[model samples]
Target: MLTLASKLKRDDGGKAGRASGASDSTHRVSIRDRLLTKEVSELEAHLPSTCKASFPDEDKLHHFRLAVSPDEGYYQSGRFQFEIDVPEAYNMVPPKVRCLTRIWHPNITENGEICLSLLREHSIDGTGWAPTRTLKVHHLH
Candidate 1:
């Protein structure tokens, strides 16, 4: 269990291991970027009917406006707008979500700040944000 070559390969003995580790991190970043692209593509291809997202400017991909309309509820036929700012490290980190609508609710403040526990950074489920749960947990119905 103690060969020079084996130790070097394991990253505890030399430069080659360090280089390998750096490249592995780079590879992971690449994969995350690609996965995000795929998720965006999926969002584009299959958007929910009750909600829609629109960009404020054509050049920016990180910022957008999302609109939601509930068909049958106290807010039936009411359109609520929200602004979503997707961070660079999304999926691992949650996007910033704001109400952007003037409404009174326990979860939403009049100033457009949202109080949803799932959307906040202190969530009990895995350090506050899980990209996979964002879309599913935002249902108004």
Candidate 2:
């Protein structure tokens, strides 16, 4: 009963609706995927071979852990753990990294927050971070 143009409109509407839903889902997944992939790669490259890091959940890459066993120095023979929380912006912004292991270090605060130049995302002037500076996990300690 419907004309060709009307039938095409109906079909296009259904297709557009389905496509819109799929696009939204894909966008959300990609955000998490991109963050996790980038974080895992960066950790693997920067972390010492002795240390191990991974994302337990493929969907939730924002949370991860690292195990560090110092070969020498005051922390020698001690196994330390760290938790990393990467924000949505990630590489463009600094991630929140903290030591899960209780260690007494001049750079680390009693509350587990690291007081390092690179870990700080904001400048002393209260302005946003510089675009060129990409801080790494090792810089925290």
What tens digits encode model 2's per-residue C-alpha lDDT throughout 52-134? 77556544567767778888888888987878787777666777889888899997787778676566677675544544544
What are the RMSDs of all candidates, in order? Answer: 12.5, 12.0
Residue range 1-141, candidate 1, lDDT tens digits = 112233224434334655665544532333344454445445654566877767675334456677888887899899999997777776666667888888887878778887766676566655455666544344432
Candidate 2's TM-score reads: 0.65
Clashing pairs in 1: none
RMSD of 2: 12.0
Candidate 2 regions exceeding 4 Å error are 1-22, 29-36, 124-141
Measured against the true structure, the TM-scores of the candidates, in listed sequence, are 0.63, 0.65
Worst 10 residues of 1 by lDDT: 1-10
Model 1 TM-score (2 dp): 0.63
Candidate lDDT scores, in order, read 0.61, 0.62
Which structure among the candidates has the greatest TM-score? 2
